[model samples]
Target: MVAGDGQGKNIHDLPDEIILDVFSFFSFNELIDILQNVCVRWKRLAHDPVLWCDKEYIVRGRAQNGRSCCGVTCSECAHCRCEKTDREVLRTAGMMPQLWTLTMMRGTRARILRKICRNCPNLTTLQLHGCQKMNYSLLKYIFEKCPKIEKLIIANNLLADRQYTELVSCLEHLQSLEVFENRRGAGPVLLRFLADTCSKLREINLSCDYHPLEDVEYFVKAKRDTLTSATVRWTMAGKRCVVPVLKEAASSLKKLQLRLFDVALEEEAATFADLGELHNLRELHCNQLCPHRPRLISLAFQPGCLPLLQKLDLPHATDLPDDAVVTISRGCPSLRHLSLTFATSLTDGALAEIHRLKHLQILDLSGCSGLGGSAVAHVAQLPALRTLLLQYIDDLTDLQPSLRHVLDLKQLRCLDILYSGHIRAVPFEEFSVRLVNFRELHVTYEEEDEVFYKNVLLRCRVKCLGSG
Candidate 1:
């Protein structure tokens, strides 16, 4: 039999790119924790550098979510009952001394985490969320052993009263720091200390009510030379504090997210105008959730911030008009990924402007109630689109038939229609192997809808990546 004839060859014969494309759906955490243990072939493929470069060499330990775990073949995660994930991660970390990325969720025991940190001394990127499950000594151990770590993320966790100052100070080479909570030890003290001691820090994301913007300003003033990305959340009443901070880091700032607690301040002094000064700014997200509604107010399309952006998200921008889309098209020529979720005022004119962006690859028009089915045609003509999201377009009844436009997108890989009101499951029946790049479909979660997609995707060899 020939190599192609199933008689002699097996999955090992398939090209690596095909396998990596399927593996891309699973996070790095899942890849090492479960899939690598399935068999020797997969274990070897699991450590492929292509996958590692895309998501880093992450070792994960997460709690059972009741859904299937491991990969597509497994129906359920029976091993989770005994917490096999943690043990497997501990073993893998020790085995793979080259691992540089690690994420430990709530399930991983503190001792196991400490062990992994002790083993992976070459780590450069580390993320630990749900830190309530562990203690401070584990972090101390990680810093002591993994001193070369440059990017660090700690979320949904707390810290000791003034211990953050001591802990973070240890990573003299730290470049990126993201801490989502600061009810206790995380605040100006940590940032201030890093500013004084560490000059390589490039990114900072802190979400807290503890001395919010005032201290961030101080850190930016001190370390503006290297700061490139900044994301901060606070309970304050105004967004004016961020103006000067952005100005200070304008020369180096490339990515920024600021929480505008009070929507009124967004329009008062045109504070967002200051962003126009940041000629180097690339990505801006001002659509922070507010007490009344979640709208990204007019952070105008400053000519300076637009041209260089590769990704832009303006979700729930109720006030965004069609003209703003015009500015986006003319200003952001290199824009690749754009999200206008719930921008209810836009019509087909916005998509027309977007169609002008020849390099656009990902488009999210979810909840754009004003858009007509013509959007389907406009986006289908785009040359490089790989992912398209149209989640809440319930009123656009015409979308059901116009979806045939998707067949034209040869590079399209993922199309999401979660909670898409009028579109039924029947249209997806036509999708098949002819659309080779199409691998993932996101559908609504009703029993009939899920069953229909499962049957169709099974025949098409596509993955149904959960429901909205």
Candidate 2:
């Protein structure tokens, strides 16, 4: 009987596992729009719980009233039809049993959020951006349902005191929390609550006030052995509130970033000295948030301070003199990345000292007007130097000699000379031929230099920036 009517092969004839494997390559949107409608077997595969795990849905566009998700009118606007559509979408997608992350944008409805928490029990990370409707009840519902959540990010959302308190109480297992643009000062209470409840908490980024600074000090003291990274953005008046925290966490803290709105005076030199105690610190960023305030130049580090430090960023510190640069070069031998942007006092002599950091890969001397082509010769000496930024170094008129010197370093990759006014011309073809390993080259933008820059771009990646 000829083996009873043999038929041609079809995609459905493949094993279920193979079909699922193929489905894995398609994104959630693609699966919904194309693959699901292909056939019954594909539809069934699309609905499989494994495909939804780690899926991310990003909804863009502002609310109908032209106000963002965190706007005051958000809760009162019943006419926001877009909210309903978003809620419907969330309700449909929230049914994924294995979904682990949820990012809610500005106009997301409260009921929709409740549906998500109720549906997606496996959610471990929740990011709320401009989510105005995030009240105490909604937050409590999420915490009660999604008990495994470990990371929560709230940006540009002004939740009430009660809401913040409830939110903290619920995040008992949260390992990381970031609250940005929080004007209401929920930081102190939140830090205290996290310190008390979330013993596993290792990372925190909070807006700093005097009260919050006290809370942070206490938190660091209490959890000195656990907390590893902390980033504080100062908003209120404070002098030495941060120093005590650093002192307490000196042995354990690995990364620290402080954005100070106020100037650090000579009197606070002792406070700055406290950083020397952080021997385990690998990354340290000290930024002066208030431009009107003179940069904290009085702050100096002794030799062997932060010996293990790999990354140091102190941009726009106008008073970073040669002595400070020398101290940094002496102290941080293991440093790989260093940024001293806008350091007006940093001269060629400082670069000579910095060249001693053999492990240094990235260096930014942007806006250091005192530096000339002589500084590049010193930079060329660094064995591991890969990326060099010399933007706004106005005195650097002749770069060809320095560029020629750097060409010897086989590992050199990125070179930036943007806004260097005095460099009248560049040997683009010569640079392209010599610097075989170059990945990016940045030059100052000029109408006349278009052809020169275009030629470089054709040979290698090039970016042009306007002279400041």
Candidate 3:
């Protein structure tokens, strides 16, 4: 191969394996738009089955001008191209033999969905988003044809009573199911069906508004041993609905996320106590929609709860105080990722405790108004920290002390300090010189400081984004 003449050594003359490897990096749409029309060799490489193995075909109904067909101006716009329908897009995408994921966005028709279910036998993940026309027949067709399907995500769809029952009856083979923002509730019948038939289910996510507490209790009691991950959001029901579900799945559950709409301080405290029983839990996300409630510091600060927990996300936890941070640092030493966004009660004291999390990697302290430069100094102690988001921490004034410490962490990759107005005056040239391994640096500065930082970052050869 090395002996070939210079004329025969062009890119197109490369081996088929090399060409296919290059094609693997491009999205399906990009491949179809650019490489497919280049030449016969490129077209053949683009059509290789390996390129489509885990590809996701996004079928959305929108005019060429990027506006909905139903919009008032779509009919008169020069680039509307309303004639191209969802069926046409699906038909073209269904020609691929190895596609494993199909995401049907708004305006997908029932007949087109049925055709996809019939044609794409290898499809393993189907996500339907805002597909108002999705009905019982289309879902049943999917279950009948794609027997090996493993995950189903249904969001913002409307299902009638009969259609809902048909959908539940077809979930016997699925391993994961996620339902969110449905216009009509699936009701108790759907839960009963899942409990009785979907015994192999390992993950379930329900964020709908119409869930009944009784139905959830029944499902938890029936599927306790088999369920491994569960996420329930926006449920109006109180502790009665949440406690039973947690208690039943305590032994087998690994990941749990709860976002309750109506909850009292005492009720939430009680719920946190139940979580202590889930010793095997690895991820815990608790969000309260209600504001101005008492802090959950005391309940979550227990010493022996969730020994294996690795990720703790409590965004919008307005009541989280510094004591809670100390508790987490002492108890959840295994945590690798932590988020305390909008936790206004946290101060430099919390950051001192958080520095003890030796394995911590990704930390998001955005909107924590109480945090200052001292907190940033504490963050530099973590050896494993990679991505740090300090957006909206307006009190962060000086970056000199923090930058000195951060330069020592060789693993740091991304640093975002957007909207920290007081720190804009620091010489970012120092940062550009010290953070040799940074992949991305996001900052916001006044117009006067932009040119200085841009020139300094250019010299350091790093990607910089935002107002600067």
Q: Give the best candidate by TM-score.
A: 3
Cα lDDT for residue 397, candidate 3? 57
Per-model TM against the reference = 0.73, 0.75, 0.82
Error of 1 at 129 (Å): 4.0
Deviation (Å) of 61 in candidate 1: 8.3
From the highest lDDT down, the ranking of the candidates is: 3, 2, 1
Query: Per-residue lDDT of 1-468 in model 2, one digit per residue for the tens?
Result: 122335766665779998788778765556656776777777777778787664654333454443322342433322111233664566455435566666665546677667767877777777776645666667778788889888777753442364565566566678877777745543344556557777788887765454545666777888888788888753333554475566787778898887864535443545556667788889988884233323223243566777899999988777766777888888889999999998877777887777679999999988977775567778778889899887876656544456456666567788888777655444456666676787788777667767766765465776666544
In the range 1-468, model 3's lDDT, one tens digit per residue, is 254567766675679998788788776556666777788888777778788765566555564343322343333432122224765665465455566777665655667767777777777787776645655566677777777678887653432254655565465668888877756544423666676777687788877646567777778778788788888863434434465456787788899887764555446666556666777789988784333344554455467886688998988877687777788888888899998888877778887777778899999988888765577678878889988887876555544456456666667788777776665544455665676667677777766866776677653433444554
Compared with the true structure, all predictions reach lDDT values of 0.65, 0.68, 0.68
Please identify model 1 stretches exceeding 4 Å from their true place.
Answer: 1-93, 107-110, 130-138, 155-163, 182-189, 234-240, 260-263, 266-269, 288-299, 302-305, 400-413, 422-461, 465-468
Q: Model 1, range 1-468, lDDT digits (tens) per residue?
A: 133565887555778777767666666557767768777877777666555543333333344432222432222432121123655655666644446666544445667777777876777887775543645776687789898888887753443245655677678888888876624543333556667777788898866545556666778899777889988653332343555566787778899776644535444335545555666767877573332322222344645455688778877776677777767776777788889889888877776766667898889989888887676777777888989998877754756455677788888888887777655632566667545687787765555566666776654444444443
* Runs with alpha carbons beyond 4 Å of true place in candidate 3: 1-17, 37-50, 61-91, 114-119, 155-164, 167-173, 184-189, 234-239, 289-295, 398-404, 422-427, 445-451, 458-468
Locate the minimum summed-lDDT window of 10 residues in model 1.
Answer: 73-82
Model 2, CA-based lDDT: 0.68
Ranked by TM-score from best down, the candidates are: 3, 2, 1
Candidate 3 has its poorest 10 consecutive residues by lDDT at 74-83
